[model samples]
Target: MAEQDWDSQTVIRKRGNVARVARTDSEINSARRAGVSIETQRKVTGNKADPGVHYQRIAKVDYADDVVPPPKLNNSVPQAIQSARQAKQMTQKELAQKINEKPTVIGEYETGKAIPNPKILGKLERALGVKLRGKDIGKPLFAKKDGK
Candidate 1:
């Protein structure tokens, strides 16, 4: 390419119409007062089934009223298990065999060193015929009560 005079070049131009300027605050307020909403329509697309169908607004949730709280683990679980095992005249080893768990695990539970999960707790409950887990009783450990 040959080097030409750079400043001698004429700028290309289109002559059709001038662009519209932004409206003033007073003009916008006047339009609002005349019941003319300047809001732009949001384009809704994606669903090939029906583009006119829009999503429903999410309803507010009342946590305390609408939600049911989970069962809280009672602190007396270890003692209850121990007492129930003794009441049934079953040793930790015997209880462990019945529940298909280790004797050490039973000992840990009895000594309040370990807390068993719901499945193991249920097995122990069935073997001992007691409710070892649930809401707090707020009673003495030795006080006998019906195991429901």
Candidate 2:
């Protein structure tokens, strides 16, 4: 007999398998004794959204007026800076330019209002050839050696 090809034909699935159970006498007795429905209960996996502990945040405030001011240069230091610049026949602006600083900074130092910054002081010392720090404030930075 010749085999027929089933691949070319359209197939239809009419229904799925159903079990019409006939309960045994023992099962029926047990169900009757328990008097409970056959439905299963839902399980809890403890994967819950928790609104966790909240802590109070601390706020930090800075009182600008309450802050201790930066230390100012000594009166002698300012006086030394001024006298050295004047002796060199240089204005505040000219000295500031020579030291690569603002004219206001030079003015402040001359007026005893500026803070003593080591870097600026060094620059001023080199530019003006004066000792602006220590006890000998207005002394020359490099002392004259004996004539060779």
Candidate 3:
């Protein structure tokens, strides 16, 4: 084999794992000790404390006073729901069953205690055949012409 010219040298790249970077024995020992301590702490105290240490646990702090309150359902909504349900000769439980919702959910809406949910309102409208929301509360969802 002829020696290659310096100007035309073919380079071969090395593959596989490179040598680990040098670390002091004390540093390596400390890392191992820290790992073992963490494992032991987890076993002893469980994982609950680790989240608070490694990540911000927002739930642990009281933010209720800082947070804005949820909007309450209007009094008109309760009246509309109650009247419509009664017009159909349906009890709260029967209305809830018809809508595939819990009786408490229907009761809450009827009492205007639940937070307004459009999906629930839509379900109620379809089931009770009335409009529980918008400008025409307690009106038929789909008004029919007297002739049609």
Q: What lDDT does each candidate get?
A: 0.70, 0.78, 0.79
lDDT over C-alpha atoms for residue 102 of model 2: 95
TM-score winner, 2 or 3: 3
1 or 3: which has the higher lDDT?
3
How would you encode candidate 2's per-residue C-alpha lDDT over 84-114 as one tens digit per residue?
8889899998998888999999989899888
Error of 1 at 44 (Å): 41
lDDT of 1 at 101: 95
Q: Write the per-residue lDDT of candidate 3 for residues 1-148, one digit (tens) a residue.
A: 9886778766598677643432567766776776632122232232574544533344435465478889888778899889988988999889999889999999889888899999999999898888877788888899998893
After superposition on all CA atoms, what RMSD does each candidate show versus the true structure?
13.7, 16.5, 9.6
CA error at residue 134 for candidate 1, angstroms? 1.5
Please give the distance, in angstroms, between residue 92's alpha carbon in candidate 2 and its true position after superposition. Answer: 1.0
lDDT at position 5, candidate 2:
88
Clashes (candidate 1): 0
How badly does each model clash, as a count of residue pairs? 0, 0, 0
Ranking by TM-score: 3, 2, 1
Better of 1 and 2 by TM-score: 2
